[model samples]
Target: MPSVRRLRPVWAETPGTVPPPPGAPAPAAVAVQPGLDELGTPLADVTFVVVDLETTGGRAGTDAITEIGAVKVRGGEVLGEFQTLVDPGGPVPPFIQVLTGITTSMLVGAPRIEEVLPSFLEFARGAVLVAHNAPFDVGFLRAAAARCERAWPGFQVVDTVRLARRVVLRDEAPNHKLSTLAALFRAEVAPNHRALSDARATVDVLHALLGRLAPLGVTHLEDLADAADPVPSDVRRRSTLADGLPDAPGVYLFRGPREEVLYVGTSTTSLRKRVRSYFTSAEKRGRMTEMVRLAVRVDPVVCATPLEARVRELRLIAEHAPRYNRRSRAPERMPWVRLTDEAYPRLSVVRDVRSGTAHIGPFASQASAQLAVEALHETFAVRRCTRRLPLLPAAGAHACVLAELGRCGAPCTGGQDHADYGTVADQVRAAMAGDPGEVVAAHAARIRTLVAQERFEEAATVRDRLLAFARGAARTQRHAPLARCAELVAARRTDDGGWELVLVRHGRLAGTVRVDRRTDPRPVVATLRATGEHVAAPTAPATAAHPEETDLVLAWLEQPGVRLVEISGEWASPVRSAQSVRDAVAAVAVDLLLPRPPLLDDVPPARPGAGAPSAPAGPDVPAQGARRTA
Candidate 1:
C-alpha cells in the first residue's frame, strides 16, 4: 500500500454545509418537494444526488451504518457534498473492518445516524438519487429514517448498475463494479472501499453513462431508467410490425420469415405493450431473444376479455404446435380415467372420452391418472385383478391374489352373486359422480394409522394418492353440471366499466364478446350469437376439458360481480358435490401431515358409546373394483 490518508467528513466546510448539534431538530431544508417536470423532462435539467454507504453488513435491519457519503450535482456541476461517520451504537465486526477499513474505534465519538441523517436529507433535497446499487444504500437510509421517526424524502432513484448493463459493452469493461468502472472511465477520485471516495467515483461513472445514452435518444429522465436495455438494431427496425396492434386485451403471434408462428402469448391489459416488449432488452430469455431475431411479422387477435385471450392462446398453441410456445400444445393427447361399462366394470385410462360413461380426469399425465386410479382402488373394494369376467363367470376361472387377500371380490370364480356385484359397481359409479366422502375418509383413516405406526414414508405415499383422487373427483364433479347444460350466458364487468359476456355450451366456452360503456348491448348480443362458434355437447364420459381455459372461465364465472345473463339449460353444482368432499379430504390430509401434537389434537377422540361417522347414503352404485366375496 502506498500511503493511507486519514479521511475527514466531506460535508465539513463544503458549500452550503451545515452540521446541526446532536439530537437537534431536522433542518427546514430537509423537506423535499415533488419535481416540477414530468417523465419526459430532459435528463440534463434533472438534479442527481449520487450516494454510497459503508455498513457493518448487508442486512438493513441487522447491519449498522458506519458511514454515509453523497454528492449532489446538476448539469454536471457539483452543488454540494454530504459525508458523515455514524456511531452505529454497536461494535463493527472484524470481517467488516477488514473489508471496509472502518474499525469500531473509528466510529467512537462519531455522530449517531439520527444526528447526521437530517443534514444529508437537506443536501439531497429536490434531487433524483443515483447509486451504484441503489437498493442497498437506499434501504439502509430508509430503515434509519424510520427508526428516527423521520419521513423519507421519497427521491426518484436511479441505479448505475442497471444503466451500465444497458449502455456499456461487455468488451469495454470486464464488469459493472464501481472499482472496475472507475478505472475504465478514468474518474478523478479512485474508490478505496470508503463511502465518500466510492460515491465520488460513481458520479463520474454516471456522467459517462449519460454520455453513452445521448446517442440512443435517451434525453428524457424517464427514458434513462430503461436506457440500458439493449434492443437489437434489426428488432428496432421492425418496430412498425406492432403499429397495428390494439391497446386492448388480446393474444399476439410472432411469425418467422416463412410465415411459421414462432411464439404465442397473451396480454390482458395491452397487446401493443406486450408485443412491443419482445423487441426490447426487457425480454431477457435467450430463446426468446433468438426468436425475435428470426421473427418477421406480428399478428394480433383482439379478445373481449383476458379470459378469451387466454383461451385463444391455448387453442392457437394446440392447433399450430408452435416451436416457441411451451404449454397446451398437446391438449388432445391428455389422458382420462374412464370406468368401462360392463357387468364387471373396470377402471381404465383412455385417450378419447366416449359418450355416456362415468369417468374422472383429464389428468396431467398417464402416471397421474394411474395415481388417481390407485387411490380409488386402495379405498374402495373395487376389483383390482385384471380379468375380463363374463356376465356369469366361467366355472373354472381362478381367484387372483387381490381376491385371496380380500382386496377384491372373487367375481371371476363365481364366488360372488351378480346382484351383489352390480351393487358394488353402482357404489363405484356414485363415488366417481362426486360422493367421494367414504373413499376420502378411508384414506384419511389410513394416513392416521400409518402415522401412528411411524411408517411416515408409507403415510406420505397414501396422502399423495388420496390428494390425486380428491383433485380428480373434484374436477369431474365441478364440471359435470356445466357439461350437462346445453347453453348458458355469463357476464362480468371489465375494468373499463364495460361488460364481458361469455357463451358457454356443454362446459366449453362457445364465444366471448365485450360491450362498451354507454353503448347499447342489444346489437352486440345479436352479433355475438351470429358469429359465435357453437360448441357441441360432449359425449358421456366427457373428456377432461382443457384445464387452463376451463380454469380461466371458471374463475371468471366465480368472480363476485359475475351474473348469469341467460341460460337455455340447467347448470348447478349439487349441494353434495365432489368439490365439497375434495375440500374435506384436503383438510383432513393437512391435519394428518402436521407435527404430532396438532395431528393428535385434530383427530376426533374415539368415544366408548359412539361409532365412527356412517357414510352418507346416495344413489346406490356398485362398489368400484369390488367383487362379491365367497
Candidate 2:
C-alpha cells in the first residue's frame, strides 16, 4: 500500500479556540453512554480520516465503488492521504461516467474492491471516520465489508454534513453541499466531482466548523454527539410563538398560520419552558421541527394538577387530530368487534358502535378486531357465517362444513335452531360483556390439542388469536367499571405535601384541583362536587367514554398512595372476568409459539388527501455567508 502526503501552506485558523466554561455543555447535554467522541479526548488529540467515495450508483450493495479518497488529520494538521480507483466488475452507468469522469474503460484497468480494500482499511485504521453525508459513504463501505466476508472495523464516525448543519447557520451558507461549503469556507482545494478533491474540501470544512464550535465549548470530540439534535433555522425563528405561555402545569397546542392546531403537548412544570424547547435543538425529531416551523401561535390551557394536564392533552389531541401528533388523533376510528342483532348473532368489526350490543374492543385496528372475532369463533363454536338466518328452517336444508367440523352451530341451515344456537351466542356475549373464563379455557384446550398433534403452525396461529382476544377483552372489562360510574372522586398525596384531587364522571375526567397541605381539603371537595361535570350513564359494556381516558383514570386509581375520596354509582367488574383469562392465555409459552404478537395494521392515520401520514418536507437552508459545512 502506498500513502500520499498532501502539503498545505496554511493550517486551520481557529477564531474562538477558547476554553470550555465550568458546567457548560461541551456542545450540549451529557451523553448516556459515551462513545469515542464522548471519551473526553480533546478535539486536537482526536485523529480523523476524512473520507470520500465515488460509486457507480447512489445505492449501497446494489452499487459498486469506483474510487476512494481519504486524508488523515490530527491537531489541525494533515498527516497523509490515500487515493485509489477500483474496477466495479460491471459497466458504469452513462450518467455516472459523465458526472464522475470515471468511464468503464478507465475502471477496467483498475483493481477491484477485493484488491483495494485491505490497503484503504490499513490507512483508515485507528482513526475516527469523517465524511459528507456519512451514511452514504459509510453504508457502502460496511456493505462492501459484509460482501467480502470481512469484519468492518468498529471505528467511530463523524458526519461533516450533520455537524455543519449544527455549527454553520443557513444564512452563512446556502447549503451544506461539498462544493458550496468549499467555496464559502475559502478552502485551499476546490471540490470537483472527484473523490480526492472532495475529501480534501471536507477536511477544510471540518476544520472551519471546529473553529466555529470551539467558542460554544465544543472542546471534546465526544461533545459533537452529546446534543440530541440541532434546531433548524426555520424552527428557531418561531421562538416567539412560546411567548406569554405561563410557567405552570398545562396542555399547550401549537397553532398554525391558519389557526389550525399543528400539535398538542403537555407540560408537567412550565408550559413556557416546554414550548420554548421546540424552538431549540432539544426537540430532536424531524417531524417536530417541521411542526415548529409551521406553528404561528401557542395556546396554553393551564391546569391545577399534572394529571389534569395529561388528560387535557389527550382530549385535545383527539379533538384536533393534529397531523404532527402521531397518537390519540383518531379515537373514533378505533375498531370494536360487535355481535350483530340477529337470531344467531355473528361478530363483526365495526367503527360505528351501535347503542346496544355485546362487543369487545377498542382494538388497535380492524385486523386486530377481526382476530378477536376469530378467537371467539374458535372458543364458543359461534356462527362465523355473515348471512342473516331465518327463524324457520327449510325441511331439506343442508349444514355447512363448520357444522360437521363443530367450529360453528350451522344456524344458517336450520341444522341448529335459533334456540340451540342461542346457547353458544349467550356464551360469546358473556365473554364480551366481561366473563371470558370459558372463552380462554376453550382456546387453551385447542392449543394443547394442536401442540400434541405436532401441528405447530396452527398452534401458533391459535396462540395469537387467543392473545388478541384476551388482551382486548381485558382492556374493555377493566375500563367498563370506571366508565360506568356516575361520579367518582379520588385523591393522591403529592411529593410536595400537596393533594391532587380529581372528579371523574362515567370514566371521563370532569374536574381536578391541587390542594396544599396547609389548605383545608373539605372546601376543595365541596367546590369540586358543585362544579363536577354532569355525565349521563353510559349503556352497557359501559365504557362509552374514550377507552384511553378510562385507562388513564384506572391506572391513576390503582397506583400506590391513591385513596378513594367519594363515590356515587357502582364501580365494579365481574370477580372473574377477562383480566383473569388474559393472565391464563399469556402464561402458555409452548415451544414453536411465535416470539412476537400477531401482526396488525397499527400504522398511523393517513394525512388529508394522502394514503398515509406524509413525511416531513425538506425546508430551505440559510443564505450564503462566511462559514460552511461539507
Candidate 3:
C-alpha cells in the first residue's frame, strides 16, 4: 500500500495516452480507406477478397466443401491470405480426390467445414467477393452457411469468367475457363485445381480485369461491378461518331474504314441513342460487335416520322446490300405464283412477273410458291398441262394423268369443253385475285375427312398446305388494295403524344411526317404534299411494289386508331371475299390441328366478309366474280 502511493494517474496510462516503447517503429499507415457506403466507395479504396473452394462435387446443395482459400486485397495490394483444409464429415469421392489432389488422409485431423467456414467468413468480412465463375464458389459457401445455421452476409460478387468473356476476344482465348484465362493473362500463380493456387490465380486475373476497366470510366465500385459488360476498345473509340446525330426518328448507316456501308438500321426515336448503343456494352451480338469495331463513321438520315424511317431503311438496305443487313435486301428476287396468259391458263411459279398476268404471290421462297400452287390445284379443276392450248383443242395433244384423275380440265387435249375449261380458268383467276374461299373450304373438308379416317399424317400435310395458301392469300388481299390506290393519307397517334402521318402515292410510300401535339399540323401536311414521292402504281402483269413495303403500309393503315385523312382512289378489300373465308377456316383449323389452345368455335363455318377489309374485286377478275355454277 505504501509503494502504490506514487502510482501515475489512470488517465496517463490509458491506451490513447500511452506512448510507444523506445526503438519500436510506428504503425504503417493504411493505403486505402473504404467509404461508408460500398456503392459510393471508389474502386481503389474498397477491399476485395478473391475466394476459391474445392468441393466434393459440382452441385453446392448436394455437395460439401473440402477446402477454403482467400486473399484480401486493397488497391491491388494483398493485405492478408487465408487457407484451410476441411473435413466434409464423410469420405471424399475418388473423382474429387483425383480432381483436387486432396486425399482423405490429409483431412484426417482437419477442422470440420462448420469450424473452418466461420474463420473464412471473418476473413472475408467487409470486402467484395471475387472468383472465376463466382456462382460455384459463392453458392457452396451460402449452402454451407445455411446448413451450419449461420447468418450469411450478402456480399457484392464479381465473376472473373464473365469479366474475361467481355474483356477478351474469342480469338484471344478459345474459352473463358479458369486455366485458359489464367494462362492468357499470365497470372502470378497458375490454377492447379487446389483452392489456394486457384485463388492466387484469380487474384491476378481480378487485378488484370480492373486494369482493363479503368479505360472504360470505371472509377467507382458500381462501375467496376458493371465491368463484365464489355465494349470493345475499337468500338468505344468510335462512339464520338454519333455525337452529331439528332435525337429523332431516323435511319442510320454505319460506315466501315473504307467508307462502305457496314450496317443499315432504323429507330423510331433518338437516332443518337440507337447509333451509340451499337458501340456500348449492351450490344452483344458477335456479328454486330465485329461490324461496330470495323465501323469508322456513322451517318444518320433524320425523318419526320417512324414510318418514313422504316421505309428509308428498307430502301437503303436494298440499294447498299450492306453485309450486316440480312432482311429486306433481296425482295426483288422473291418468287410469285402466276396464272399464264393463254387460251387455257396453267399455274406456274415464276421469278419475273409479266404484265397482265394474274399472280397470287410475292412468296418467301420457291417452296412456298409451289405449296400455294399445290393447294390451289387440290381444290379447282384448273389445267395443269404446261402445253399451250389453242381455242379449239388440237387432235394429237396427249392428255396427262392429271386429266384422267379429274385433277385438271385437260384443255390441251380437248378432253373438256371450251366453255367448261374457261369456267375453271375463271375460278382459278378469282382464287388468284384474293378469293380463296372455295379452295380453302375444299382442303378443309379433305382434312376433316382424313381426320375422320384416323389418317393423321396425311391430314397434317393437307392442313399445312391450306395454312400456307391462307397466309399468301391474306398477304395478297391486305396489300393489293394499297398497291392499287392512286393516293392516300393516313395518321396514327404515337406513344410520345405526337401524330404519325403517312402519304401513299401510286401504292408506294410517298412521304411521311410527324406532327407535335402543341403545333398545328396544317403546315406539315402541306409540306408532305409538296414533297410527296412518285412511284409506279401496282398494276397487273408486273410484280407490284415490293410486297414487304406494301405490307408495311397496310399494317400501318390497319392499326386500330389509324384515320384515313384523304384518298384519291378507292381503298377497300372485297366484300364477301374468299380471303375472309380462308382466314376464318384457317383460324379454326390452326386452333384444332396445331399445338394450340382449344378452338374458339368447335366447327367454324366459312363466313363471307367475316374477317377482312372490304374492297372491290381486282381489275383482272371478270365482272361475274369468283362465284361459279355447280
Candidate 4:
C-alpha cells in the first residue's frame, strides 16, 4: 500500500525533475491511485492524477473534450504528467480555437478519444480526481466513458469550485469563475483555456484555497465533497443531469412521486450547472434538504426573457396552488399600505390588488409588516391609525394618548397645528409613491427650492438626499436590464422519454435526461434535444447587448465546424412574436423569482396583522408588513 504523506509545495518541484518514460503504458495498464489531499490537507499516502480537459463549449454534455492534462502526485511530489489533444470527430469552432489557440491544423494527426481514453483511465485509476468545478470536467469524462462503453474510471472528485465557495471565499463574492480565481491566486499561465494550463491553474487555486481553509476541518476529499451547502439528500449514483437539461432560461418544478411540487425555480444560465449548484452549495443545502429528498422528477416551462419567467412562476403558483408554495400566497392576499388623499393625511390599508395605488406591503406576516411600519413611523411620523381627522373631541373622549408620545400629531385632540405636520406627511407620501423617477424629481425639486431660498445648509442636506435617491434609481435601472435579460429554458425527460420546451435566450442551453442502459448518449442527445426545441428568443434589447451580441456568440462558436446561421431575420411580423416571446420570457423570469425554498413560494406577507385577529382593514397592517418583509 502507498504510504500517506504530506505534499511538497509546487515550487519545490521544478520542471524537468522527471523525464518521460520510453513508451506510454498499454491501454489496459493498471490505473494510478489518485491523491485525495490535492486540496492540501496533510499529505495522504495515496497518489493523485490531477487532470484537466479543454472542451469545445461550456456545456459538458454538448461540448466535446479536445484536450486532456493529467499529472500524478504523491507524497507531496510530482510523480508523472500527461497531456494531449484528442481529435474529436468534428470540426473545432473558431472562437474556441482562439480561446485555446488549438487550431484544426494543429490537431491533424492527434489520437482519437478511443485511443486517449484508456491512457487517461490508466493514469487516473485509484486516484481521487481534482479539478476546478470538478463536476463539469468529470461530466465530460463520464460522457467519454459512455462513448467508449466503459464505466467512468471509478474515483472520487474534488472540486476547487466548491472548495473556493465554501471555505476559500471570505464573503459573498460577485462570482466564482475559475479564471477569476486563477487571476486572484496568481497561478502560472502557460496558455489559459488550454487543458494543461487550466489544470495547472486549478492546482494553484486549490492550493491557495486549501491553505486558507484547511484549519476549518477540510482535510480530506470526502470532507470537501460533503462540504456542499445545500447537500443533496439524494446522491446521484447513476443519473446525472448532464444530458437531461436544456441550456436555456426557464422555470423548473421539482416534484414528488405523486406530482406535488417540491420546489419551483428558474435558470437563465445552464440548467445542469444550476441544478448541480443546489446539490453542491453549502448554504443552499440547508434551505433545500427536504426538497431534494422528495424530488422524483423535474418539470420545466421555458421562457424567452427573465421577466416572462417571473410572470409564469406567479401564474403557476396561483393556478396550481401547490402545497410547496406558501410564501407567495400571503403577499397576494394581504392588504396594501396606502397614503390617503385627504387633508392632514392619514395612512390607510387597502386589500385590493390594483395599479396606481401607492402601497408599502402585502407581507406574509401582518405583525412583521406592522412592526416595520411602526419603526418607519417612529423615524418619519407616517400615520398609523386612520380616522376622520380634525374632529372635535367626542363627548367623554379625552385624547388618543399616542398624540403626546409623538406617534400621532394629535389632530383629533387639536394638540398640534395642521400645516406644520402636513409638510412632513407630504414628504413621507412622496417617498412612498414607489416611482423612482417621481421620487428623484421630488427630491431634486426640494434641493433646488432650498438653494433658491438661500438655505445653503439645508440645500446641501437636500442635495445629498437627491444624490442618494439618484444612486438608488440608477441601481434599480441597472437591475431592470438584468431582470429583463434573464430567462430560462427547461427540458426534462418525459414519462415516455421525449422532451419539450417554450423559449430560450442569450444563446445559453440546458436540459436533463434519465439514466438507463444506454451507450455514450450525453453529447448527441443533449444538443439534439436543444436544437429541436425552442432556440433562445432574444428580446429587442438583447440585440444591442454590450460587446456586440452576434459577435460574442460567434466568437464563442468560432471553433472548427461550429456555425451560426441567422435563423429568423428580424421577423417581418414581430408584434405578436415579440409579445409571445415576452410572455414566454416573463414566465421564465417569474420562475426565477419563485422563492428558492426548502419547499416553495415562501415569500411571507407584506402587511402586519393583516391575516387574522384584527379588522383586516386596519391601517397598521400594511406599514407593519412592509418593514418586516423589507
Candidate 5:
C-alpha cells in the first residue's frame, strides 16, 4: 500500500501534525478568510478542496482506489495540497497503471482505506468540493465514507464538466472530455496522470470554464449551482432511470418517444453509469441523437447475482418484445449437453431447457456451447457415434477406442461398471454447472489418484480439463448480481469457538448480536426468529433452558394476530425489512434512524415508490437481482 500522509491546513494548523487520540477533542474550527478583488476591494471569497482519484477500475464498490489527490484553493491561490497512492488490496490491472502511472510498486508502502478516509474527510471539512466529473469523484468518496462509517462530506459540489456543457458549450461542443476542454482553454497538464496534479489541472479548468460562463449570468456560485446543466432532455430523462436503482448486477431498459423501447443491456458495473453512457458517448448526436430528443423515460429491473441477471435479462427481453432490443432467438435454441433417460446414459445436444431433460446451458452463442459439449464428450467418452444403447450389453459391458486412447473409462463397453459410471456422470454434471472451485477440487483429486498409480497421460488430460473448466467458468460468471434485495448473512467463528451474527440493512452498521453454539440447537433458527420482532433475552449469549428459544419465538411471531416490527439504526436504503410483515408487534429496533429519501418511480401506469428521493442516493454497494416479492 502506498503511504498516506495526513493533509494539514495551512491557514489553521492543528496543535500537532499527528492525529488526536481517539477520545481527544477535535482541533478547534477555522473561520473562513475573505479575499480581495483586483481593485483591492474585499470579496466574499470561498475555498475549495479540489480532488481527483485514479482507481484500479471504474466500479466504485468492487474496485480498489489506487491514488488520491487534492488541493485547497482560495481566491485562485493554492493553500495546501495532498497526494498518495493507495494499496488496492487486490491486483492492479496493467491498463490502470498505464493510464494513471501509479504502478503496484508505488503503493507497496501506502496506508489502507481504513486509515486514509478519516484524514481525508477532515481535510475536506468546511470546503465546497470542485471537480471535473463531480459524481465520479463523489461516488468513490461516498463509498469510502460508508466503509469508514461516516456520512459524506456535507459540502456542495461544483462540476466543471456540467458547467461547460450547460453554459459554455451552447454550440454543441465536439467532445466534453477533460482533455478536450483543457486543449480548448490552452491549459497545460502534467505528463503523468497522478491524482494531485490532475486535481490542480481540474481546478484550473473550473476557473477557465467559469470565465466563459460568467458572461452568461453564471458569476455567483449559487447561480451556477442552481442552473440546470443544459443536457439533452433525453440525457436527463435517462439519468433519472438510475434513481432508486439497487447497486446490484442487473439489466436496464431505455424507452424513446411514445413509450418505444430504445435499448436493452446489462451492467456488472454501476447501472447509473451504464445507462448514462448511451447519452454521453462520443456518438452523442446523430439519428440516435434525434431519437434521444424525443426520449420520454428510462426503466430498470434489478437482479440478484450475475448469473441471475443474465437469466432474467434474457427472460425479460423475450417476454416484453421491447422495440429496441435485437431478436435474441439464438439463446433459446442454443444447444445443451444432457444425459438421455436410459439404462445406459447417452449424451446428446438438446436445443432448449423446456425439452423435459436436465440440461446446463442456454449459452448466448451456439458455437461456444457446442465446443463445451464436445470437450466434455471427449473427456468422458459418452457414445459420440451413437448406435442405440442396450443393443449389445449392460451399462458396463463393453469398451470403445476412447478408453484405449486413455481419454475415457468406457462405461458403454463394460470396461467401467454402472456404479462407477454414475460417479463419472456426477463429475460431468459439476463441470457443466460452471463452478471452478468445485471442478478444481474434483479434478485435482482425480489427477492425484491417476498419478499415484503411474497413469501420467490420464493425469495430464485431467489437468487439461481443470484448466479449461477454470477459464470457461470465468467468462460465464463475470456478471453482477440479479436479486435486488437480500439478507446479508455473515457467520464468523468467535474466540470461544462460538458463532456471531452481524446484520446490516443496506450499508449502515445496524447491529452486532452473537449466538452461542453450545446451547443453541440452531443458530439460523435464533436469528430468523429475532428478525422484525423483539424477543426479550439476557445480554449474554443464550444458555440451555432459556425462557425464550428461537423456534418458539418465530412460530408465535408468525401467528395471524402478531403484528410486524421494525429494527432501527442509521439505515440509508429504500427497502425496509421486517416492517410490512411484523407491524403492530413489538419491534426490535435501533433509535439512531436517519431520514430516508424518496425511491425511484417505476414506468407503465406507475407502481409505488416512484418519486426521486429528496436527497441523492447513498453511496453503497447496489443490491442485486430482481426485487423480491413482498
Candidate 6:
C-alpha cells in the first residue's frame, strides 16, 4: 500500500515477505480480484480512487505506513485528491528511504495512521477503488483501517495491471507493469517512486486500458471484468474445439499439435461446458494454460452411464499415460504381500501379482506392504527368513534370532519339523485368505498391554500396523469376489426411476448403459451382455484388470441400491469364522495380541468383572459383508 505517493509498490516480487489479505485471489486464478461486486455500472459513471502508499516493510502485520496519496476521478474528471505523511512510530529502513526518498526525519511531526486513515477512507468513499495490482494497495489500506479500529467500506475494486493484460496484447506491451504501460500510452505524468506521481501515472494508464475495451463491447464496469484475462486470439479461437462435444457425461482428451493426448478429463454433467472452461479464465493451472495453447483438437468419448465414464477415464489414463493426467498412471507398481510357494511358505512383498489365494495386498506402497507383512509376522509363528527351506530338517543347523524370540518357528534351520511349521503356515494362510480374526485379536491384546504399561508410543505403532492390515485386508476382500467372477450384470436406480446397468467380467468393467424412467431394463441388460467386450478368464488376486479398476467396480457394486441382475461365476467368498482363526493361533499365543480381521473394528468383548482394562485401539477400522446380489 505504499509508494512515493501512489504510483508504485515498493514490495515488488518480494516473495513470502507480505501476506495477501483474506479472500485474495489465488495466483493461479486469472484476472480480477474478489471483494468487488458491482460490475453492472457504466464505466463512465464509476468513480476511481487511485491510491498508493509507502510502508516501512512489505508485511502488513509488522509494517507501518508512512505516506498515503490518492486521486478520485469520475468520467475522466478529477473529483478530489488525498495526500498525507504519517508518523510510522518507527525508523524507516535505509533501503526503503533510498527507494522512496521518505526519511524518518520527515515523519517526526507527521499525523499517525490513526488520524490519516479515516480521512482517506472518507475521501475514497463510494468510489470504485483502483490500483495497479489492487490487492497490494487494497490490502495495505484494509490493514491500516483495522489498526485504526475502522470498518472498511466494501468498495468495488479494479486492478489496472490485470485489466491491461486483458486489454493490451503481449506484442503491444511486453508486460503489464504500470511504468511500462504509462510509457506505452504516453501518459502526460510519469511515475516516480513518490506516491502522488505514481498515482498520477496510474490514472492515465487506467483510462487508456478502459479505452481499449470499446471494440470488445466492454463499456460497462461489468464488461471490464468480462473483458479481463482474454486468451491470445489464436487460443481464443480454439474454443471451437469444444464444439460438437455432447452435453452429457463423458471422457474428453485434449490432443496436442502432434495429435498426442496432452490431457484427459471427464464431466458428468456436460462435456461442452467443462471442456470450454480450459480456453477461458476458469482454467488457472499453468500447465493446463499451456496445454490449451498447444492443443489442436478435443476428442471425446461419450459414455451411457457416469460409472462407465469414470471407468473409461481410468482405463484411458492407464493405457495412454497422458502427460497431463496426474492419476491412475502406474497402478501395476502397487505392492502386495503374498506367501511364497515353498516347502515352508512365508510372507513376501511383491509388485506384480497374478493369482494367489494366500496373498493380501495392492497396498499403496512397498512400505505399507512391508508393515502389513511385519504385522503378520508379529501375530503368527510364520518363518521370517526369506531363504528357501530344505526338504528335510537339518537338526544340526542353528535357528535365527527370530526363532529364539518366538517370532518364527525357524523352519530354515529345521528347529520346527515340516508338519509343525505347516500348522503356522496354515494360520498365516487363513488370515491372508480373508479370515482376519486371529490377526486382529492378537494385535488388540498387544495394544491393550502396551497402553496399560504406559508405552503409548509402542501402542501407537501397533495401532498403525493393525490399521494398515485392516485396510489391505478389507480392500482385498472387497475385490476378491468381483475379481473371481467371470461375468456379472448389475443395476442401480437413477434419480428419475430409470436404471443404470453395467456389464463386468473378471473384475473389469466391460460395458454399461442407462435405461429411461418407466422403461424395462431386462432387454437392455441382455443387450449389454451380448455387446460387452470378451474378457479372458482372470488369474488369481483374481482380477483381469488393475487393482485400482477392480476397487472402483467393487465400490460401485457395494453402493446402496445397486442389485445384481445376472452372474456367470462365483460372487460369494466363503465366510470363515473368526473363532477358527483365533483357535488356530492360540497354540502360539504369548503376549502381544492382535485384533479380528477388521482391524479398525471388532474388538473382543472385555472380560466381565475381571477388572481387566480394555484393549487400546489400532489406528483404523474396517467392515462389510459382500452384498448378496444372488
Q: Give the number of the best model, judged by lDDT.
A: 2
- lDDT by residue for model 4 (1-630), tens: 333334455333322345346796644545757555444433344566778888888886677889999767764556777899899778889998988888877888899999999999888878878887777788999998898898775787777777687754555445788888877777665437778777766766766775665566545555555664334436442135334877777677777889887777767655666666555433344436556666777776777544345545655665666666654533235544455665566655555433333344433345434543443353455455666665344455445667667777665556555776677676664454322334434444554576567676765444333333222222222222222333322322324433322222333332233233343334434454466434444332122122112222222222222112112221111111111222222332244332121211221111222211121212211111211001
lDDT of each: 0.74, 0.76, 0.74, 0.52, 0.52, 0.74
User: Per-residue lDDT tens digits of candidate 2, residues 499-613?
Assistant: 8888888788888988887887767877998997778877655454676777777767656566666666555555566555534554664333535443222211111221111
Which tens-of-lDDT digit does each residue in 1-630 have in candidate 3? 111112122211322235679999986766867555434566767788999999889999998888998888777667888899999878899999999899889889999988888889889999999998998999999999999999999998988888787678899889988898889889879999999899989988777776676665566677766566467567788889889899998999999988899999999889999988887877879999888778888899988777778888888988999999988678768888888988778889887767676776677878878888999889888877676778987778788888788787677776787788778878877877756778877987887788778787887787767766665665565566566567777666678777777878755788887777776655666677778887766564232455666666766665566655556655556554544554555565665564332221211222244222223322211111112110
Candidate 2 has a TM-score of 0.61
lDDT of 5: 0.52
Ranking of candidates on TM-score, top first? 1, 3, 2, 6, 4, 5
TM-score: the better of candidates 4 and 6: 6
> Where is model 6 more than 4 Å wrong at Cα?
1-72, 75-238, 354-357, 445-459, 573-630
Model 5 ranges with Cα > 4 A deviation: 1-44, 167-173, 231-630
Worst ten in a row by lDDT for model 1: 621-630
Could you say which candidate leads in TM-score?
Answer: 1
Q: What's the TM for model 4?
A: 0.40
Residues 120-139, candidate 1: write the lDDT tens digits.
Answer: 99888899999999989999
Off by over 4 Å in 1: 1-50, 53-68, 71-130, 135-244, 541-547, 594-630
Write candidate 6's Cα lDDT for 485-543 as tens digits. 78887777789877788788988999988888767677787789899999887666647
lDDT of 1 at 476: 67
| Lowest lDDT 10-residue stretch of candidate 6 | 617-626
Clashes of each: 22, 6, 7, 99, 46, 35
